[model samples]
Target: MSHRPKVIAGVALAALLAGCGEQAATAPSPAASAAAPTSSAAPSAPATPVAAPDLEADPETVATGLDVPWGLAFLPDGTALLAERDTARVLRVRPGARPEQVLTVPGVEARGEGGLLGLAVSPGYEQDRWVYAYYTAAQDNRIVRFRLDGGGAPEVIFDGIAKAGNHNGGRIAFGPDGMLYAGTGDAARTATSQDRDSPNGKILRLTPDGDPAPGNPVAGSPVYSLGHRNVQGLAWDARGRLFATEFGQNRLDEVNQIDPGANYGWPEVEGTGGGSDYKDPLVTWPTDQASPSGAAIVGDTMYVAGLRGERLWAVPLGGGAPRAHFTGEYGRLRTVEVAPDGALWLTTSNTDGRGDLREGDDRVLRFPAG
Candidate 1:
């Protein structure tokens, strides 16, 4: 569960089923929103199919020849800020210019999954010029804030979190509420995913200053939800519904609708199943098919980046479970983000030492959101 290179730890029974079980399962609690439908049964009636437009019949490459681009954040001016995992450098990409190394962060451990991972611009970027990043430090995975101006030093905001070489959860974004939300890996410890006291393997809600949000389930705790493995992606729909993509252990990879105080089965459960206390995944994929990474929501569709699956998946977001749209075209897609132009930009990760790289390995490509 811990993204780092470590061994799995034992699970704590109380935390494992905390607020999840028969009593909570029957009731429609706020936490129930995190459950995903796993049934193979067909719907009673087929809804009118909405045709998806061809965003990119031939997807064109935007940037190329990178070490391993892990995270991407778009500026208001249409340029992009990219994080290269192994290099610990942040590159700026503009429409008609070459990529430029704007900043090189120090103290980043470039082991397995421990490096510069996710990036996000502040909601008040015009005034603050703040950029947030998730990376592995010598002690643990931490979140830091930095000014966009070159040579500005990073100020540590959150620290003392569990870190693994592989499952380090590293996605960070600003919610509509102006609060910062972070998705963390389990740190190779299964019980940590369910521990409210532990920041590992959980979705955290915090203020811009990295303080725990006021309305969290537990006072003074930033944990939004628990029992997650390696949560790589987070997105919000037009209706403000939060969704996340998590890497599975061996059987099922998952996409879940996240709700405050929700508990997702990790060491106890993997895919969808009937449970009174815990929430199920809205969608499940074989681990090989969907090592899902970053996600972006557009209109009624959720576009997810597939790492091992090597494809872009379009999950219909009309309120039910997600179904795969397309599979196996691009190789090792790592990040999927909605650009300011309304197009979806996907970054490839084949060069990240995980998969086989092709002719244009480690590139950023753009596609229309059909």
Candidate 2:
């Protein structure tokens, strides 16, 4: 894909605002210290596999025979849309039926951890029949919108996001305010995470037309917050608190309560430290147990997907820090989304060139939360 001039413009803008001081740094609580390692060589025990919780027992497979399925979104009428990263295909799946390819998008740069990654149904999907996606094009990772016409071409709504092979964050969701929100990565440039002017490492809030949403933290820009490395998952709880899952640099992975305009430390800090300006993560896990990807919130609990950790983490959340309930059940959990029937739908990433692949390497699993 050709490099769009807008991407360079965005980078220039980011460089101008990269001088902001780090903010809101608090020491990680003792609980957080116990969950995550303090240094790179900290001796930590391997995560033990636990029995499938009763709520997750009898998880019926929704789809099979897929290649690196990354994200899933359900239509208003109950059909599902899934994105296959390497294949560059968007599939429409009906219950108990074969998945049909809706469209094969072009301009995908399937390199390393980058590819077609996240998908979301438009907030007005019942009327518009539009689906939004985040993918790595040849030049950059971008978010685009398309109509879900089976076997037809997808109309590109927007393009020119920052892209990198490893930290190409690609999770998108429509927030409660009827606006689209995208989580972006820093494209291997750590300073970009702290650059408020850049869209690369921020939570972007935009209208359906891809314009900046009203009352954004940055006037005339879609950025809601700054200082993020690679945010891959976004979800809202019943209480309307937004949460995001982040990939840590080396030692710590995090789940944070996303506050608008907040600064989350990236290059300056890893797990937790004291600086008084950067916001500390509410929960941190060792990178080995929680290279988290996607997340879903049901009731007071948050279900997070782990890529390298090879587990599905159940975190109970209310106000204080989140607590881990279960770890290491399904290997390499990739995506977790709330289903219409109230069950949490999850996908695996073992076949995504990251880990060992067993029989039924990549399949969708459902866990009904009681």
Candidate 3:
């Protein structure tokens, strides 16, 4: 199957915005999608997985006037640090205030889905005041850290990953275990994804200092897993199990339980190959409906931000049938984060050159999360 651009999602919703240009009404329930998988495909049956929480309340617009916001991370003080992909600017937003530009990164390439992407506050942020970012540079994709005060230059902690016009993974987060985890795309090079020596197309585990984490899948190698086309989201459940959302080539999109040293077939097989060596996705969706981006886990449920699909997905931690919400209601969902106040914060990506732009082309929305 060829990769067709599913442009209907974001464009259709632009005409439905309120007078203030916000999505004020509750979205209709999603139609049953055949792409959703059942529990039988999961790694294991979860023991008493938590039920889905309520998000029935109308989502509130938290911030507006964003230019293709791509990443969201909250501070201890409840301020949101947002990243704009093409702008290479990080904005700090309060719950009821406009977003303020806090930091601007230098040397960003910002071309074709590659730019200043994922942002993560250091685990010891209160003391260290460090905020990490994954972005595309002129030569390769890299990760850098900067202080919150904006006084000093960005410290390049990691670099030399391959770069291209597309498929630059660019999602970074500090794991529960205190290691920095990064998801990288294949740079449109299929061979690089399968190459252990190449950093592209792999989930990387690193120390705060950018060295490979101890006890990694391979000695002295930063790669924690291999064989990915474009892994844009990474989250951890209460049990510290890692989950990731992947963009497939043409046929499928995936949510996989990531394991150390595991190989998820890319350029070889997709969806389910029934191979023991390659791990299968816990859930697979049609490529048109689920170009999943960012993910967050709250309690025993995981929420994925769907881009092409234009929806939010709730999946059980123990692996089961997934549910969809706000389908086509908020066009081109970019990032979904569990906010400090226990709300689900999401950003729209209609302004990212792929969707129809409205009066408020991109905005931050808050949904009640139990």
Candidate 4:
């Protein structure tokens, strides 16, 4: 069947989807999503996956008057934490409510494209209550975990990734296997992407307690995949396939299917056709239409937030060209995520010093993806 943007997942499923990153107020929590997958390496969803939600053309404004908001992870209560890219502040956000500053992360050095970036709630949050963040520190990019009420310094889980005025890849998420995954930039140093020993320009996988994941392709190292320019988005399909959105050179932007130890040809290639040594991107967009950042997969379709393109692209996993939605409506889209209630939460990045700023330059929007 051809892909359509609209499909009903029912009201009950809608409520369930609205809490993708947050805890459910009534019953099980998002941490349940982190429960050890049956397969320590790969966990594919059942054959009969539920129908994916549709993406509504119009959207609802959730919150306003914010700086450049980047990382977004929801709480168990269906609320979310918003990371301000420049201010290094974390805020609690929900619809129809004013966003309140929750904490100011220290050691966040907001350079050109750095500062506080991605956020992820612990899948085992009920017991651990840990929140993870990726940000630019004084000397390098780092990943840290902390608790809202723990009243202590954040624990640096992973550090020593390169930092730069730009290309400090800072998107992170937990996979179905319950391991933490991070995308790092080459920090403008093209060689780092091809060097297996370098942490930059690669996707790193780690255990929840700051150790390298046991099943990583490289033993004793967090490097899961290598040879990426700058990966800003990571998501999994219903069948446990991992996809990542990347920022390329002026020539092309790409979305690649991530494989353990796979090489995506950065300094060697841009879009595709890198002989047999590198994996080609599943989808490629012009730099103007993509500069893709955060993405959220609902069923078979992946919705990605575009930065320079100023639009949202809905891609079909079964195979097809991506369709753009809300193009130019929300300036400089930063992040897009699926909510437990089956809606899509998108953040605008016009205030991030690169786009045209409007009344509410940087804001959060809710799309009816139910």
Candidate 5:
């Protein structure tokens, strides 16, 4: 499909399976190897802002044998924390090292495509010592905050998001404005995408304390934007341009450059041609080629992980056609994040009940972004 000036489209498909496999071996964390900070939530070294990124180098193996690694985040000291979709465990990962269990969230019900999903450290972590999470609970999808040590029960800052076997849009991050942002699915209720009153199928903005952001479109509501099918990936460029990757139902998928209070037509319009009522996507791909999930941006380039497509996509900002990377070389790519050392990190999702599992079924890879 031609991905030129077209508009479009997060999560779908999976089953209730026990996340298997034991934790990988451990190594001293970056902090333990250096000066440990008071909080493990410090932001990683900012990815170098450049005019372009180079991804030609072969990727290096970071770690292997993970149980559906879904959410990937970095700390100021360059170590990583990841969330397993089925295991409900957060792990500490390092380069050429093994993953060690950090803490398992309590009451996480690992339903289809649900469970412990997205992870983000506080923008003010050094002071707040808080790490935020979005996950599937017994009753609904919710967001909570807690420290790594299990210091206290996770404070339920937000709740009542509809849950389902699939389409549980579960990606969360802190925007440049230091406000918490979440992409939610319609929970298979197609009509909710166009409903402003429902949080489903919307990108929501809130204070870290779980209140509606001060400048939300509604005076006291959390709906930053509505009409998304299932948003699974969120990232921002150097200019603070927020972009999201969404899962389309059958025909099209999208990478949208987000605007405040904008409507991304879903259920109403799949790809483009929504007219003035909805904002079109910056790029669109056939569903077969881009079930785009986790997204990370470096310089002027965006890297999106493709789950069913089994590849990584490099999308350039200046009217450049997106190029594919490692197509089918890594099966079912699930998560992508820019590491503190300025490398692109990707996680494979072979063990996520869909792909043909390899010897090292689920793994993480690092590629140069310089």
Candidate 6:
């Protein structure tokens, strides 16, 4: 686990999960409340109709001994890359090999819910060889990209989003449109979620070079949508509909249908205000049972990772209610990605100074789509 050097030495396990390596809630959204809750609500039912997904499978252990793995990305050749939150190291796992350290990111302040957070392999990886990441430093949170070959230093592409010990939103991915999208938190500032001018508490769209993506809701601005508090997951469906999950404050957690220029009620409303001025969540859960983290969409179902709920949730598309999978079986599911081979790749966060870490506490798991 020593990170004294830069290069990761080896590679480990590999399997093509059909479309893997791809890629909320709501309460007052942590924007209305400045204090973090000591405990979440008890597991409860989804607010809408609930039904099972078309596919479900038991998970198989893929890799172990990973300390606080947060982000996962897949290479063109099927190698999976993961990031450790506290260590700031990127590790690679190929097929049937031991997980080896790839490179240690420099200047990551591994404090609270920060450190090395999210990772995204370039869609043009075969040509560009760039890997993007979002992490926290002493002063703020930022996004940077580096060559996958480890030939150059990490270049800062975006910065200035506020950071806090807890609600530092850190999920980043490339949309089907090939634009880079990032989810951010309000940094305990309620006003930021309502501030269209600030990047904090918003879903941002940017070109590959970190400039605001063209056709944004506002001219010359990166903000795609505002009024979000601690969004950790972003995924797109077959129709290119963007979905995001947000951590709620105290009452309701939510899954929202993201639209450009749409204002998702944060400080103004928690779940559904039924007002035309704000977009409402497609699905809502008690903050306890669905502290949603990372997410992936396969077919008509969207798979969401639950942190406080300790379960994987499957939401049927077209506004059906969501159902929980693997309830309480895995401790603190942090991230879920669909593999290229049609399986789901999941990670655990029990060792992130929170949940009880059992044997093989922090590990990577694979669940083939049934």
List lDDT for all candidates, in order: 0.76, 0.72, 0.78, 0.80, 0.78, 0.76
lDDT of 1 by residue, 122-177 (tens): 97898889898999989899888898675457988888788877789899988766
Q: Against the hidden reference, what TM-scores do the models get?
A: 0.85, 0.84, 0.85, 0.87, 0.86, 0.84
TM-score (C-alpha) between model 3 and the true structure: 0.85
In TM-score terms, candidate 5 sits at 0.86
List candidate 3 stretches off by more than 4 Å: 1-53
Error of 3 at 153 (Å): 0.7
Residues 1-370 of candidate 6: C-alpha lDDT, one tens digit per residue: 1111111111110110011010023222222122221112111221211232333555677888888999998887777999999999999975467788889999899888989999998889989989999999887888989986778789888888788888888999988777889999998898888776677888888877787777665546777777788899998766566789999999888887676666776888777763656777767898889899999888757889999999988887644457788788778999998766666788999999889887897989886655
Candidate 5, superposed: residue stretches over 4 Å from native: 1-48, 51-54
Give the lowest summed-lDDT range of ten residues in model 4.
Answer: 1-10
In candidate 3, what are the lDDT values of residues 83-114, reduced to their tens digit? 99999999998777788898889988899999
- What is the number of backbone collisions in each predicted candidate, taken in the order shown? 20, 9, 1, 18, 5, 31
Better model by TM-score: candidate 2 vs candidate 5 = 5
Q: Candidate 4 residues 110-181, lDDT tens each?
A: 989999999999988888999999999998898999999956988888888889998999999988778899
RMSD of 4: 12.2
Name the top TM-score candidate: 4
Predicted candidate 2 versus true structure: per-residue lDDT over 10-49, tens digit per residue: 4434333322232222222434322322212222231211
Off by over 4 Å in 6: 1-57
In candidate 3, what residue range of length 10 has the lowest lDDT sum?
20-29
In model 2, the worst 10-residue window by lDDT is 39-48
lDDT per residue, candidate 5, 1-370, as tens digits?
1011101111100111111111111111222112211212212344345533456777788888999999888877888999999999999999867899989999899978999999998978878888889999988898989997768888888887889999999999998778899999999999888766677898888889887777665556677777899999998876566789999988888887666666788888887777766666777888999899999888767888999888899877545578898898878999998877777888999998999898776998887655
Question: TM-score of predicted model 6?
Answer: 0.84
